[model samples]
Target: MELSKIIPVSKPVCRSSYPDNPHSLCRRFDPPLLVCFSCKGQHLENRRYYYYCATCDLEFHRGCHLFPPEIKHPFHLLHPLTLIFLDPDFQSSRIPIDWPDSSSESDDYDSYEENPGSYEGHIVKCNYCRKYLQPEEFGMAYYHCSTCNFSLHRICAYIRPPLAIENLKCHDHTLTLFPRRVPLPCDACGFSLDTPFFDHVYSCLLCNYMVHRTCIYLPRVIKITRHPHCLSYTSSIVPSCELACGVCRKTVDVNYGSYSCTKGCRYALHSKCATNKKVWDGKDLEGVPEEEEEILEPFLWIDEETIQHFSHDHHHLKLRQDGGSHENKFCEACTLPMTVSDRFYSCIKCEFVLHETCASLPRRKHHPVHKHPLTLFHPSSSNPHKVERKYYRDGFFTCDGCTRNCCGFIYRCSEQDCEFQLDVRCASLPDPSIHDCHPPDHPLFFNFTSGSVMTHHLHFFIQPHHFQLLLHHLHLLPHHLHLL
Candidate 1:
C-alpha cells in the first residue's frame, strides 16, 4: 500500500491533465531551473509558484498548466489551435484527396515531431522566422496547429505580434496573413506561391492581390549573377513592348513587373529571373550609382587595302572590294561562297581567300560556346582538349561552334578540355561594330545570339538594291543574324 501524500512544499497545482502524466503533484523548486517543461521558458530563481512535476527533471508553471486546451492565435485566425504538447498525430495524413481515407488535413509533415528530442538529420523550417529551426528547438517545447500543420517555436509564439504587413511598392492595401496552403498566385512578383505546403502568405482582400510574405521584402535594386550593373525594379512592365529576359531568354509580360538597367541599357529581366538562387547574390543596392559601360572598338587601322593577317604567316593579304562573281569562289573562314560586290581578303598569288572581317580575327577569343576562352588552333598540332581520335584525311575539322562538319580554320579550347570548336563567324564577333556605309552614332553591342530577331528599334533601314549582286540556287541556312 502507498503511504500518505508528502507535505505541501508550495501551493497545490491547478487541476489539469497531461497526456504523458495525468495525476501530477504540486512541488516548489529548491533551485529554480533555467527552463520550464510546457513553455521551455526561464523560471525566476527566487519567485516560487504551484508546479506539476511528473519527474524531477521536468516541471511546468501554474500559468503554463492552465493553458486553454485549445486557443485561437492572432497570426492564424482561420482555425483555433489546440495545445498539443507532443502528439503522434503530427505525421500528417498522406492519403490522396480523392481516396476514401483522404481528408482536408495535411499528411505531408516534418519528421521533427515524430520522435520527440531525436531529429538528427532533418531540415525543419520555421514559418514565423522564415529560418530553418535548429534541431534543439524541435527537441524543446513548441506549438502545432494540426489543420494547417503549421508549427511555431514556443518562445516565438509569445513575442510574435498580430499579423499586419503593408508595402507601397507591392500593394497599397493593408495585408492580412493567410496561413493555409492554397493554390493562389501572387500579384507582386506574378508567380504562384512556390513555397512548400506549410508556408503562409499575405493577402489583400480589397484588390484581390496576394503576395508571398517574403517577396514584400525584396530589394528595389539588385545586381544579378549574369550582369555587372545594378538593375532597378520596375513596377509596371508594359505588355505591348514584348521584352525578353536576359537570363532565361523567356518573354516578360509588359503589364507585369520586372527589373531593367537604369542607364538606358537593353538588359531586362523578370523579377523571379533576377532573384533566382542561381542568378542573384542577395545584395540590395537600390539608388546606388553604377557606371555605364561603353562598347570598345575591336581593332585599329592597319593600312588602306593591304594588311597583315593574324591566321596567315608569309605574305600580306590584299583586300578586294569589287571581286565580281566567280564559278566556285568561297571564303576560307566562313566556308560560304563569296558573291559579287562582296569585300574579302585575297592572297597575291596563292588560292587563299577570306572575308575582310575574318582576316582581322583575334588570335584568342571569348565566345558563349564555352565558359573558358578559346585560342585559334592550326593544323599539325597537339590539342589537349580533344581525346586521341582519328580525323578525316580530307583536312576537315568538325566545328561545334557552328555545329558544322567541314574543313576550315577553327578556334579550339586547349587547357580546360572544353570541347568547343568555332568557325570564324562564331569566333571573331567584335564587342563594338560599325557599318561600312551607315554606321550608328553609338557602336552596336554584342549581347547574345538566338534564332529570334532582336527587339531593338532600328534607326534606319538601308536599301538592298544598292549592289548588283550575283544570284545562285544556294539552299543554305537562313536567318543567322548577329542577334543584338
Candidate 2:
C-alpha cells in the first residue's frame, strides 16, 4: 500500500526517561530532526516530531502536542489559559498585559499548573511580535492566562493585531488602537507604559499625538551608549547648560520629551533616556549599515598590575591583595560574598579570584542608581543554570542598594518601567572605603548609594570631603563594616 510503504510501520511515539537518560528508554524522536517545541520551524533535516521529555531534557512538539491543555483567549477572557512551556523569564506567568478583559474566572484559576520544563531566562515578549519570543520559540508555547495570572506569546496566542494604525509617523492623521489598556505617557516619548503589550501604543482621536510602536520613527539623529554626540531631535529646549542626563544623571525635564546635542552639544538624552533597554538597541537605526566600531579589549595586563583571564584557564590572573578564600569566599565575578577585607584580584596558584574592583569592570558604567548604564549582566556564570531563578540559591530579587534580600548580579532597570535593583551586594561597594574603617588607614567615603526602606539610607561612611571629618552613619555590610 502507498502509505509510504506503510508509514515505515510506525511506533516510537513515547517511551521516555530522559534528563539525559536516567537509565534508558529513549525512543520518541518521532520525526523532528531538531527544532520543534512547536513551530519554531524545522520540518526535516532528519525529521523529528518531538516529545522527548527524558525526565526534563524536554523536547515536545507534535504541534506542541496538539496544544489545548486549556486555552480560551479573547485577549484574556478572564482565565481558562494554562498551556505553559516555561521561560517567561521568571515565569510565574504574568504576560497578557494588564489583564482583566473579564469573562469570569478569577480565583487564580484553581492554581494553574503546567510549568515544569525547568526555567532559564529567555525573556519571552511577543504579545504579538513585540519580538523576543525566541529560545527557539520555546517549542510552540506561550499561554497561561489561567484566570489572570497572565501569559501568551506562542505567537501571541495565535495572531490577532490590526484594528487601526495607518499613515502614522509624525502623523498627518489616522491612528487608532488605544481603545483599552491604559498607562499613557507617550505623545512621542515621555515614557510611561514601556510596553510588552498594553496595546504597545498608537493613538490620536485627532490631536495629542501618541506614538510609540517604539516611538513612531523618531530619530532625527541618534547614537547613544551614553553619548559622544549625534543626539539631535530637539523640538524645543531652553537650556542655558546643566540639562543633566548624559545617561541618567537625572534632571532632564525641559517641559517634556528631549534628545539634544546636534553640536549645541552639552549632551542630553531622555526621551525615556534615548529609549534605553541598556540605551537603545531595539533599533530604528533609521538607515543602518555602517556599524562596526566597538573593539577595545586591551587593558588586560600582567605587567603594571597583573592580568590574563579568559575566565581562568589553567592559571595567570594575578592581583589578589587580600583576594579571598579561606573558605566563605565567592566573587569569581559577581557570585557575591568575598570579604577578607575586600580588594580582590587573585590567582597566585589555585583558589582563583577577582574583585580588585572586579578586575576593572566598566565595559560601561553610569549608575547613579539606574537610568541605564549598569549593563554587564552575565559577567560570569557560564552555566549551572546561571543565577537560577524562580528563587534559586535563595535571594531571588531585592536590593536597590541594601534594602536587603540578595541574589547576585542584577544591576538591572534599563527603564521600561522595571523598577531597579543592585544585588551583587550593592554591586561590590568599596568606593572610597579602604579597610581599617574610621581613622587610621583613612579613605572611607561610600556615600549611601540610594537606600530604600524609609526616607533614605545609603550613607556608606560619606565624609571624606577631602576629609572634613563627620564619619558616623556607615551602615555598610556585605560581610562587615561598623560605625553606624
Model 1 over residues 1-484: C-alpha lDDT tens digits?
A: 0001111133333334554555555555455645555444555322344355554445654335434345566666777655444323322211111111111233232222222434345444555654565433333234667778776654445443338786787677788886544566666566767555334578888877777776777779887534555788886664546666775556776655688876667778888777775456567877667755443332333578876565454556778876574326766666667667568878776767777655555666645324345566445333433433343245676655434465556676644544556665545443333443434553333333331112233533221111101001121112111211
Put down candidate 2 lDDT per residue, 71-116, tens digits, no spaces: 5665565567666655333223222222221212122322332333
Runs of candidate 2 exceeding 4 Å displacement: 1-137, 140-153, 157-175, 178-199, 212-242, 250-255, 258-484
Q: Please list the C-alpha lDDT of all candidates, in the order they appear.
A: 0.52, 0.49
Most TM-score-accurate candidate: 1
Instruction: Judge candidate 1 at residue 48 and give its lDDT.
Output: 49
Candidate 1, residue 361: how far the Cα is off, in Å: 6.4
Displacement of residue 2 (Cα, Å) in model 1 is 49
Tell me the lDDT of candidate 1: 0.52
TM-score of each: 0.41, 0.24
